[model samples]
Target: MSSPSTQPFAMGGREFVAMMASLQALQALAIDAMLPALGVMSHDLGVDGSNERQLIIGIFLIASGLGSLFPGALADRFGRRPVLFVCVGGYVLFSLAAALAPTFGALLAMRACAGVLSSGMIVVSSATIRDRFSGDKMARTQSLVSVVFMIVPMAAPTLGLAVLELFGNWRWVFGIMAGLGAAVFVWAWLRLPETLHPEFRQKIDVRAIAGNMRIAFTTRSAIGYVFALALIQGALFGYINSSQQLVAEHFGAGDLFPLVFGAMAIAMAMANLTNSRIVMRFGARRVSHAAVIAYIILGATQLFFASGEDETIWQFIPIMTLNLCVMGFISANFSAIALQPFARIAGAAASLQVFLRMVIGSVLGALIGQAYDGSARPLAVALVAAGVGCLLLVMFSERGKLFRRLHGQVEQA
Candidate 1:
């Protein structure tokens, strides 16, 4: 089957990549950018709790995952642009609702709603790429998206910190999310054309839905890789939940915690830039397998350091930063691999894949947060468990295959 583009519109690979990257940017802008404000929100609402701090992160993801299922079913039925427009609109409304929430519970509920809407943005954005690209090109494009993802994250913490310092409150972060949501909605509404063709639309008949789901689940490589990628992402989320506590509380990172986070962000960005160049040449599997191996090695070292030592900031930074850098390659490449087998079912596949990625990752993030004991032990343990498991699964699923195996595969229909 041919990929999405026929004539290759004015915004082909580069524009598509940049635009898709905005979806990730919007997410980071929503969650991470709101973090510094969580304390203020809790204090303002008289919430007076510790978990409220992480609620800013967790609630958004929970809602996003729940919101993903329908858009997949709808996107191919109606067309991508419509779904994109609605999702972005949903994000804007919910972000504003969150900003205006009168009580802590109201704000939390709105945050959850925002996540639900945001998931549509995430799912459709990936589907847009599947419409236009496939195989190693798809992986490379995703790598560029990963780079944009990291760049936004690198700035988000510092930005949030600055806004909190100047404004002395958290609602401004939500205000920013509202503004961004509005701008992106306008940009996408104007620039993105309808990519799904009428002939390709799947009616929402039971038989059609069942047939699509069966096709998605029956694809061995795609299913295996999606679960594997989700497991890896769960590990990443664990780090996200624990990183600040680990750095600030355990390592005495103080206000410099953002700097530490920024350093790791830089490492992840470098890996993405490297993947963008080589993923096309080597294919995603060759790149991913190597990166997973590196991830396992790095994770094991971190686990060892935490096992016995009064570990200093110097010790943790090197190993944890290395692990995250390797993950940039693993995250996008594994996703590209997982989605490579179904063209007709690309939206369904991305939806399911993203759902599990969120569900599993959020759970792991919660688990790590629960295990928090004023130490880095929980983060290190979760990473080692999740990272090594991902490597083993990749080995088993592919039967020692890498990019060489893709010579005969679809990468996605």
Candidate 2:
């Protein structure tokens, strides 16, 4: 295979980032938009356990992870555009099917299928960005994408609530998702170009695919950062899985849920936007390392103060916002660092990276979420553990070193 080109598409930088952000935001929209509807859907679907209601979110995440494992190879083999179109189509179809599902089991099955298809967007968007840039530039670009992508999470629950209010049914939430998917599909179809260069395209060979997988998994930084990303994401997923319950049940602020969630998301978006501007100067490692340390400190503080039923919304909001803001710094940088060595097999590398992050994070997060006891203690404790674990992983990835810029310095590990 030929070396990957740094400028494979003709689009301007801003437009490209917007397009990629929109594609990536699909996953966020799918998950977050359904949050406000979870209660109503649970009652309608006759779900028995309070914890099982979260399966509506957890199932999609797990399915997305399972579905994500193959899209990179498929994108590398067939090309990004075609695979993306097919995936979006499946996402649309299954979303509609989910709305029409007659039983809870059937709805879960459709959601899982939708998640599988949704992996195409996540893998292909990252691979597309990888095809165009590398190093800190890639990190900066991803931060920019995240700035735009965060808009969905900020608005999705509110949007879901609005849709529910307008239609007076939870099923319409899925309909809205289908509508959004269709719109994005049409936009991508009309404007997006294939980013994979012909010389870089790989044949569907098991031996070659295995070799690339080995390269991605064995690289010390790649694997370490992958797990770090997963751990950090686990904390975020735990929050998402329990955000509705935490705010409504614990704080007695059911109506204020969207405002609280949106505020946190806005903080994250602002952090990513700031990161996009400063990442090139400070480097991905330095920024991400500082962020992780901050995350740990914030998590520890929140855990200490938020114990038992005494925690208040005012106490929870600021700490969670700051922690998630730090997450904005960590997520893009860690992903870029992990993908730095795999230009030749970016699709596969991104697939595996996302697969591990989503599967491990979603599962661990779901477990933490299920352990919720009408208090923020479980979430805080889980986040503290996740932050510490992420810091250790970063240390291992850098061979006991931290905060060194990767732009000019030789990697010690």
Candidate 3:
């Protein structure tokens, strides 16, 4: 593997961002595209409970979280491209297994395995970004990557629905995932270069791995934002797990569920786009701090509306869109901030942080999802509570400080 300094990226900035975004998008597609098929999938697979279908999404995410622990270490030992190929290949195989599963349990098992594989893609992508950039510049690049990343969430359900309409089967979703995985594998094999510095490579030793993981977790400057990211992820995942139910059943959007959900994604994507432009000026901390506070306020307003038994989609969409818009600002900034401290062990640090956030987020999301009672109240409560939890964690991390800029170019606003 050649160092980035010796061998420049074969691709330009736009293609690089696009490839990274596509790697992350595979994970989003695995979840979002399945949302529309949860009902039919449950019925076909003989699942008896409505809430149980939520596991189709929740299990994959939880498993992905657990899987995050290994990829960065492996990428550090090996190289980014090889680890990516392995992940993509495994994802394709598991996706095919899922498409052919005879029962829901088997399908879920396949999903879990596939989730584990896809985590490598996500962690490696982040580590690759970390290898090349840091601080506010990294945040801006991540925001740009996220802008493309948001496209999958915005369109996956609609694409899933189209597949169902065209093919009359839900399993085709997995087939599509497999096809896309293969495509990414080919793309990466052809163009993606190893970004890990040779000097930073560690031998695959248990103690070293443990030590690296510990450093990532114990870093005073980074760990708070890591936990804060987890709290915020809980809210985000809760919405994802419950969104179809909330839109299609609770609010009775029915077939229009995809459109409604896509609209919320658009709100988030726009926020990311705006953040990319302005992040270098205000600094990630200042922008994200303000956004998270706004997130709490929006959550409170959403709760107020959802609390009423008579809450309408009209009451829900606007507040919820605003809530997600703020979320768009929170995630990329938090990730960039949390990752700012690590340079030498970027892969392992990224791995540990991703693991923490994914695990915490998945568990909390599953709990919030299961609390569904034919209304948005449970999700609303979870969102507000997550926002407050994140705020306190951020405060603790910053020693009660907020909006302090670490970058000299970006002044304290």
Candidate 4:
């Protein structure tokens, strides 16, 4: 393993915030950047149907998760900067391919490849932070990241809308993705320095890989964090998969779908805004624990009303907003908590977390989407079930406590 220097890469507060925001902006650019064009992509590629459009989003997530898994081990062995370069380069290439894909299968394949490549950026950014910070500092820094992360995606559809309006094609969205990937690549190449040192960099011995897998399992703290991340992420993925269809098809919102989507996203922004302030004071553990319970209760209530004669758009929007808000809070903190335990092997740990969240979440999202019965009942029930399962997983993994033992706050009591 690479021996990290005691000195962190020094940046002023604003610079650090900018770097973190860049990572989030990159991610937001990938997914939401394409959302406004989902309809156009479907028509151009001959997958011109409402349900089929989700395949575009679902497949990319599945691909990205799988892509990130290997980097964990690779990152521990090789170093951070090089892997980031490779991944960003791959993302740029594949984005171009996706923009130029001639058929439905080709587009799907490109999206999946692009997803896989992008995870490198995702995994490395988190692991890089882990290399230099831990505990309160980690949570606080991550809170800033979570806030920016929340905001970029919130703004993505608007970017896509403007682009789509100008170019009158979804391909332009991929062009933007490609352009951003290239710009970030150049910026990283010029500005980003390697954080991990040679001293602790591990060798790619098969034995070490097996050993880490064993460690991940035996380490209850790590597993608990991973499980919660996976479950909560699955719920979010389900919502993303179903949202455009639900708003337009069920609520008949038409072009105003983006407005509705943005309103709900604003709720998420509020939650992350709250998360930024709350995590440092209350700590990552307590807030994350409470948020899970809040999500479950909120989701169950929404499900109850949605299952009844609540066709009023008024009824749907506020309930959905609350559910998404809680999600925004839980996601970043749970990841920080899970990640706190595995800073030494952050790449592998992040890969495991990413894989479980993406692959499993994608599967669950597809399952729930298939159960869509014209009413919001399917999504509401799915959210509640996911939250309940996630909460239970966290409880069992913690052996009843919700706060992470990994940070050695078990005595906080």
Candidate 5:
């Protein structure tokens, strides 16, 4: 089958990549930008206990995952632009609502609503990318997009802190998010044309959506990779959920939490930049498999330092940064591998895969976050468990094979 890039695209390649990255980057902004405000938000909203405050991030993720299932089906029928517009509008509205939330519970409710809307951006953007590229080409494109996406994570906490310092209110952080949403909305409206083809549009029926999802899930390679992605996401979420407490309080970074967090994020971005340059030559399987093995090794190393009470910040930072760097290689390639069977139903496939990864992964991460005990051991343990579990799932997906490649592979219709 011909790749979607064979058709004339409305926009040029560089612009397309930048726009898609910006669409997905909003989610990163929504989450990471709020990191610096967690403690202050909890205090202002009268939230009790360190652990309870984590619910802010956890609830948003779970809601995003749960809400991911529908947008693809809707987009498959209606076209991507409408769904993108509605999702962005809802994101701006709920962000405003969250900024005005009077209680912790109310803030969580608004956050959940905002997360649900934000998920559409992810589903649509992935579907758009899939509409253009396949196999290693898709993987390379995703890596490039991620390289750009990583900038938001590196800067978000610092931006959030700036808002807090200038306004002395955590509410202004959400206000800033709303402003960012508006900018992205304008970009999408002007530049993003409908990528879904007319012939590929399916009727919006429950049975059809279910069948599409089932096909995506039951495909041997896709299922294994999807589950593995979920497991890896669990480890990332675990870090995000408790990063404030871990970096600020345990490591004594305090006001410098953003600097430490950004330093770690730079490693992941550089890994993605490298992956984009090398994946075409090495093949997605070879590159991702090697990265997973490296992940497990890094996890083990972190466990060594974390299992003891005397582990210092210097020891923990390097190993943990390597683990996240490994993720940059694993995630895009694994996703490209998993979605190889769904050329026709790329939207449905992306939606269902994202749903599983977000929902299941968020829960596992929340468990790890709640287990925090003034030490890094819980995160280290979760990291190890996630790496091993992901490796197993990948083996199952590849039928016990590792690092095998199908030369000149392309997505199947």
Candidate 6:
């Protein structure tokens, strides 16, 4: 494979960001596109209870976390492009299989497998970004990628509804996912260059991989930020897992579910766009730290006001939008901070970071989702707890220091 710097990029910045965003957005597409179909899936699959429908979403995340553990190492050993191709291929195959599933268990299994494969796309795309940029620039680039990525969530639910309406079945949704994956796969094959530097490539050895993993874990800031990111992601996932039920059942807004979810996604996207511009001046720590504190306050207020009464759609939507707006500031910055300490092990580090984030978030979010008791109280309480956890983790990561930006600390890949 050619060295990243020696080879001319097949695509420019706009196309690069778009391609990377699409790869990352695939996971969102898979999850969000199924939101409108959950009720149908529950009935068709014989899933009992309202809460169990969340498993269709939560299970994919859990499986993605587990499946993410190995992709980083593979990407490090082989190369980003090749590993990505394999992931996209597996994703396409499993997505197609999911469409043909005859039982609920079969569908869940297929979705889980597809999620595992999709984890590679997440890991490799992140590692690729790390290979090309670092520090505030990395955060900025990621925020830009997120700006594009959020489009998927904003449109996914409506797209799912449209597909269901057109095809008259939920199975066609998975077929759409498969087709989109195939298109991305071909685009990537033709345009995406290998970003891993030849010098940084490591052999696929158990001891070496273990040593690298130890390095990532032992690094104070990396692991601390990883866990913090996980907690915040847990809160986000909790919202996602319970959103359909919250809107459809609680508010009786079945047809309006997509608009509500899309509004929140738009809020997040706007925040990301703003972060991409301001992060360079304020620094990742300052921006994300402030956002987390605000998130805590909002969560607390949401829990306080939302207790003992049903929150009207107006009240709930604005509060949730503000809460998610805070997340837009947190996610990209935390990810960049967590990956700041490693270069040669970018792939491995990205994998471990994503694995921790996905698993912890999946489990914590699943708990909150399963605790759904016909109200948004559970979600509010869970968000506050997650915010507290994030604050603690961030404090530990910074060695009790807050908001102090280190000059000349940016890592160059």
RMSD of each: 1.9, 2.2, 2.8, 2.9, 1.4, 1.9
By lDDT, rank the candidates, best first.
6, 3, 5, 2, 1, 4
Tell me the deviation in Å of residue 111 in model 6.
0.9
- Residue pairs with clashing backbones, model 6: none
Per-residue lDDT of candidate 1, residues 47-70 (tens digit): 766654677678777677777777
lDDT of 2 by residue, 1-413 (tens): 12354344567788888989988888888899999889889888888687788999999998898788899988888888889999999999999999999999999999999999998899999998988888899999999999999999999999999988899999988998899899999988987888787877887999988877888889997799999999999989999999889887778878779878888899999999999999999999999999999999999999988874577788888988999999999999999999888876889888988999999998998898899988899999998999999999989989999999865433211
Is 3 or 5 the stronger prediction by TM-score? Answer: 5
What is the C-alpha lDDT profile of model 3 across 1-413, one tens digit per residue? 11262256778889989999999999999999999999999999999697999999999999999999999998889978888889999999999999999999999999999999999999999999988888888899899999999999999999999999999999899999999989988998898877888887877999988988888888777888889889888888888898888889988999999998998898899999999999999999999999999999999998998888799999999998998889989999999888877777778988999999999999999999999988989988988898999999899888999999974332110
Candidate 5 per-residue lDDT, tens place, 1-413, comes to: 32353336689888888888888888888899999989889988888689899999999999999989889888888878899899998999999999999999999999999999999999999888888788888899999999889999999999999999999999999999999899989988987778888777877888988999888888987899999999999999999999999988998888999999998888899999999999999999999999999999999999999988789889988898999999999999998888877878888998998899889988988888899999999999888898999999999998999988887654545
**Error of model 3, residue 65, in angstroms:** 0.3
Per-model TM-score versus the true fold: 0.95, 0.96, 0.97, 0.93, 0.98, 0.97
Off by over 4 Å in 2: 1-8, 408-413
> How high is the CA lDDT of each candidate model?
0.77, 0.89, 0.90, 0.76, 0.89, 0.90
Model 1 poorest 10 in a row by lDDT: 1-10
Clashes of 5: 0
- RMSD of candidate 2 to the truth, in angstroms, is 2.2
> Which stretches of candidate 6 lie above 4 Å from their native place?
1-6, 410-413
- Candidate 2: residue pairs that collide: none
- Residue-level lDDT tens digits of model 4 in 1-413: 12354346555665666675686467557877777678888888788766788888888888877887787778878888778888888888998898899999999999898888888788888887777777766766776776666666777777788888998878888888888878878877776677765665767888987676566555776577677777777777777777777876688877777777877877787788788887877887788888889999988988888879756677888988888888877887877777776656667777777777777877777677666677888888888888888888788767886665344533100
Each prediction's total of clashing residue pairs, residues at least 3 apart in sequence or on different chains, is 10, 0, 0, 9, 0, 0
